[model samples]
Target chain A: MTQPVLEVENLATHFFTRDGVVKAVDGVSFKVGAGEVLGIVGESGSGKSVTGFSIMGLIDPPGRVVSGSIRLAGEEIVARDDEAMRKVRGKHLAMIFQDPMMTLNPVLRIDTQMIEAVLAHDKVSEQAARERCIEALSMVGIPSPAERLVAYPHQFSGGMRQRVAIATALLHRPKLIIADEPTTALDVTIQSQILAEVQKLCAETGTAMVWITHDLSVVAGLADRIAVMYAGRIVEEGNVSQVLDVPRHPYTRGLIGSVPSANPLGARLKQIPGSTPSLGRLPKGCSFEPRCASASEACRAAKPDATDYPDGSRVACFNPYSLARAS
Target chain B: MLAFIIRRFAQALFVVVAMVVIVFFGTNVVGDPVWMMVPGDATQEQVEEVRRAFGFDQPVYVQFFRFLADIAQGDFGRSYVHGGSAIRLILDRMPATLELAVVALIFAVIIGLPLGLFAGLKPDHPASRAIMAGSILGFSLPTFWVGLMLIMFFAVMLGWLPATGRGPVTTFLGIETSLHTLKGWQHIALPALNLALLKISLVIRLARSGTREASLQDYVKFARAKGLSPRRIVGVHILKNIMIPIVTVLGLEFGSLVAFSVVTETIFAWPGMGKLLLESIQRLDRPLVVAYVMVVVLLFVTINLIVDILYSALDPRVRLAGKSE
Candidate 1:
């Protein structure tokens, strides 16, 4: 098998504050092969976004990847300094932020930003960079790519702005693209359109993707594989269909069940009994123990390591759904 | 863009007209200019001759009309005590003030911008903290007190530079300024440094805050994410973005320095508009005083207009916003 575009192992990003350390991303492990999309789904504060930022080495002061090995295409990136990390960024790996504005410079023209991205890592002439930027723009379905290139970000609509951002990431045809919910702010139609365009782009360019989002439905449609995160840890990992159709972890089951379409009309969406556990003050044993219905005394006695199931999905639960079904 | 400029110009005209009214009536209301013209031995008839010659004998409203009419012809009347046409005197002295202000502003920008940007980039760095502490002192010390201390240290103690006065002037383009000569440069150096002390700190603070804000902007992060070197990020993105505010503050401060250099100029006796302002106000040289204020008003309007143009040029968002407006 070809090597994956990215391989992350035991990644733990922590935020140190006067109050206490917030374990934003604790022991997240995943891999994305070229041309594959791995959707990381969880509610807000589940560390999905932080995971992407940690991979990009964009985490600011007080928030750091304290422990982990992030390998992009076989090289370890976790311990790289800012300068070394910068060289890897946008060339080997690129990121699309949640707010397109967060990726677009407000004052600069689209072409200036796009071309700069190209020239930053490549020894290309201005003309070649410009050509690449225009091509990237049209590839993402922006009409009048030439005119759009001359325009500032504010001139583009929200959907178009996101397309521009996606286009910029596509400029270098990076091996890995980590999108932090780029379409979450858009309306349903625009979101789907951007998703389809991005997915199509990734497929065409054979670029691997890590799409972080809180929407399971989005993952069901777009992701090849899905990793469900809860309280800074990946609670479930498997093929998107297998995980969505029959989640082994109770947290994954709760997430899938809470989707509005799963519930009967006019009924309150099914909710996991309690809110997410705060990372700093998690339950003694399993992070999800207080919220799981079938949890037992053993579940409260120790944290569960990821258990590999026969079907190839992994769940970190002391009393997983397979056992319950066997009984 | 043209419409914006025209609109700004109209607003400026309104302000200048209002300022004309204030300069005429505001000064008149304080006391009569006629009082300064009177001789102690003059009889009532002699006093009336003095009043008529100076046009103070007319009704207040008529005097205001005549004031407006004289301004229309660009004839600022003769100075009461200075014994010269007010406009010519101001024009003659203008280069000296410009020279002093230009030197000070140069000093301010050279000393302030990099330090400000550096401190802003690393707010917690030891050198940054030291710069901030020095800026506190810069902003705290009174300009005159600072000026005196500068003279004491550089002139009295070291005897390296001259103590006072605009020395050994050179003529250029019909303007007399000491800026061309080494002695002249040395003479203006201490006063210019003194004048720049507060403004330098002001620029440093402005640059620092501007740097902080610009560094936090999304594009800067995007730049970092693009793998651009730190040099490119700070040089191209943060610096260009911060130039708008820094230019604005510099323009306004430069204008104010031109008109309001009373303390710094007086302390160093540099012979600028500020010293002229103090002298004209005391002697009731109404024409000179009004002309000085008008020049100041003109400088302010021109600087603000320049700042707006620069703002639009630096920020495409502003230009696009102007178009939408």
Candidate 2:
């Protein structure tokens, strides 16, 4: 098999606060091949976003990668220093944030922002860099690319702003892009348009992507594979269809069940029984056991290791739905 | 833009008029200028004659209108003490005060901005703590006392700089200044530094808070994510955002510094408008005092206008806001 564009192994990011150490991302492992999109699904504070930040090396003070291995395009990134990471960032990898309004500097012109981004990695003339920026803007479907370059970020609508951010992420055509709910703040129609644009860009450029979001429907439409994160750990990981159609983990089943569309019209939405436990005081056993309908005595004794299937599906629940069905 | 300027000017005019009325009545209530003008043993008729001569015998409202009329005609009357045109005395002292204030403000910004940026960027560092501590010291210590200590240390002990008075003066750009020569700089340095103490602390606190807030903005994070050098992120992204607030506060501050630098001027014995105002108030020199205050009010109005214009230049949003109006 060809080398995957991104390979993360047992990545754990912890925040050392005065209260306690909060394991934001603990033991998350996934891979995205060229042109493939991996959707990390989790609720807020479930470590999904931290996993993305960990790979980008953007974690600030008190929050750090306590243990992790992140490989980008066959290069080990965990051991790289800030200076080395900077060269890798925006050149070998890039990121798109949730709020486009905030991602771009308000005071700076589009051309200034984009041109400086290009110059940061490549030593190109201002005119040449400007041309590349113009091309990028057009690629994202923004009209009058040349004229738009001189406008500030506020001049654009929210959707257009996100498109600008997408264009910037694609400027270097990095091997990977970590998009953390990039469309979550946009209107539904604009969300679909940006998703389609991103999908096309990835396919055409063969850039790997890790799209972190809590929306199951978004993943259903965009991701090739899906990983369900619970309490900072991925309890299930598999091909999008295999997992969505027959979720092995009880938490995954609960997630799919809770989706309003997954239920018949007029029927009540299914809900997972309890809230996510705090990472600092999580149980020794399965993190999802507290909320799992199929939880049992053994599930409370020890944390279950992932059980892998020949079809590449993996579930970390001891008594998964598949096993119960067979019995 | 024209409408905005006209509106601002109208507001300024109204404020100046209101200030004139207030100062006119306020000074009358303080003490009669006739007493200050007459001798201690002057007879009642002599005093009465002096009062009639200066129109002090008239009612307060009548005197206020007369004062207003004199101002409209560009005649501010003579200083009872100096016995000259009050406007001339204020204008003559203005250059000295303006020179001192400008130099002090420059010193404050130059020293404060970098220290504040450093403290803000490395908030937990020992050096940052020390910088903050120094700023606090600047804030707490009285300017007069600090000026004396500076004189004692740099002048008396070290004998490196003069203790008091404006040094050898040179005229440049048709304004008298001590800034044109090396010796002049030495003379201005201690006084300016003394005046700048409070302002320095103010700017440091402003810049530090601004930097801390701007550093957390998503654009700054995005700049870092773009792999831009640290220098560009802080110098361009962070600095540009912080400058909006700093420029605004400093602009208003520059006006007050010019109008109310009495303590600093007294400490160094600089012949500035603030010192002149202080003396005029003591002698109950009504015309000069009123003229000096009116000049100060005008100075503040002009400065506010300039600050508004500069605000538009620094922030594009401000320009748009003006346009929409």
Candidate 3:
């Protein structure tokens, strides 16, 4: 029922490195509606972070969005020049990095950075920006935000610093936020706390979020929809609960089954048999063919098309669990 | 903060005291330097006057204590050559050296910093490569040769500026300084630029490396992600982070500029402390020589203190290091 804020279609980002060309994000597509939290779940190097970077136009040299269409509302933004992207960045869209220190300039005070971020998009005076920055900090549950504004980033704990990063992302009330493992470095308790706070924030503000992470439990609790990635493609995607309970694609199932809680007590967690395939030398057909339990000859011949089930789940596998059972 | 400053000052004073002892003994005890210090081929009367100068030629310890007492009152004894305050003569010459060093520093920073920043931003670009190659020449070429070439072109060939002397001295802030009028600027410009050549090269290398490293930091990426314009991100975010090291190097370089401007000063015939120092060495002016060495030591400590203060101000983490988390 909500309006769509982001639509990424057939996006492929690649790195033209000295050694070889790497398909960082190959033909990935997803959409997030207003207030919807779309969790992009995957192992490291699965193109999850690249997908986030591609959407934000944060790709640096040797790596670029080779072929893609990214639209915010109706604006085609994939190839927009940096000046134009500056207009869209921090206003229509924002990003949260994995490390808060990366977001916080060490020599600058928290207030200086936050106020500058506010002033970047708004034509407000410094007094107005300062007030807004303070309010933003408090909203993120920072105690004595005025004092915190004067403190340096290193003065704060890692969790508090990430909270500051989240606060900064919320400053413009951007339509979409691409957070690349923002709390993967935090303690578990801090991770849950940040997730809950952010979830509450999106619920209240109706901001769409793309949370890129390797943890399934994190997405299970926060996302409205989950997209499971393998190598550089979305292997399976569906409503979070449905995907977690009955993952159609073998990669998604293996991911869910590997979680300690999903396994019966004392049973060794089930892991996918082989490591993720390197994108440059991916196997023909399915990239996961080497590790697939249900892989058939057809699965190795070519990549399979994503099949839709009556339950509204999509799986990119030649022999999906639900389809196999139906046969 | 006051306590921290006081502690650092006390530490600095301790170092100065240690230096004073070494310099006093080294200069006073070596080769009958006092005898050497007596000018005009000391007659018996002049030699006796030297003894009376140390309080009736009091015992060495008595003379040392009296010397210390006089130093505490800002009297560095009288110059053997001029028979005036050695400290005042050094102070009189200080402003000229300071002016040249400061002008060189200003030119170096204003031109070198931005050039280095661009070079770092586009390290592989043709223009940046040219800048780097130019800096290599700056580093390798001799300063004396560079000074001669500049004089030959600007002074000899073009006849735009004067060749020598601090032209028509004017006093400002109760200190004598060269006139900023056309003549004064013309007089100092050549030597200042020549002295700056080496430092400009130093600053360029430092800024380039610092910019390259800081630009890759996460905060720089974050600045870009904030949608800050490229100018703002590089100018503010990147510049502030890289300035710490540059400031450190600049402080040390500034001290070297003051102490080592001897060659440039001699070449230009600019009457700065370095030139005065060279003259005092020839005269074997004991009090003046000791005072000059001590004054330079003092300059180094004071500069170090200023740099530390500036560092703590720019980087709060350094200021709050042991005080809080």
Which clashing pairs does model 2 show? Answer: none
TM-score rank order: 2, 1, 3
For model 1, how does the per-residue alpha-carbon lDDT over B75-180 read when each residue is reduced to its tens digit? 8888898779998888888888989999999999999999999999999899999999999999998988898999999999999999899988878897787877
lDDT of 2 by residue, B89-159 (tens): 99999998999999999999999999999999989999999999999999999888898999999999999
For each candidate in turn, the TM-score is 0.93, 0.96, 0.91
TM-score of chain B of 2: 0.93
What are the TM values for chain B, all candidates? 0.90, 0.93, 0.85
lDDT of candidate 2 over A13-65, digit per residue (tens): 99999989998898888889999999999999999998988999999989999
Q: How much is B128 displaced in model 2, in angstroms?
A: 2.6
Which 10-residue window in model 1 chain A sums to the lowest lDDT?
Answer: A318-327
Residue A45 lDDT in model 3?
91
- Please, what are the lDDT tens digits per residue for candidate 3 over residues A1-327? 544799988899999988788898898888888888999999999999989888888899889898979999868999898889988888889899998766799888888888888988999999999999899899999999988998889889999999888888889999999999998889899999999999999999888999999988888899999998888999988899888887888888788778898779998788889797777877768898889899999998999877777776778888888745533
User: Which candidate model has the greater lDDT, 1 or 2?
Assistant: 2
Model 3, B16-45: lDDT tens digits are: 777767766665655554565567577999
Candidate 1 residue lDDT tens string, A29-132: 98898899999999899999899989999999889999989999899999998789989998988888787756677767788888878888999899999998
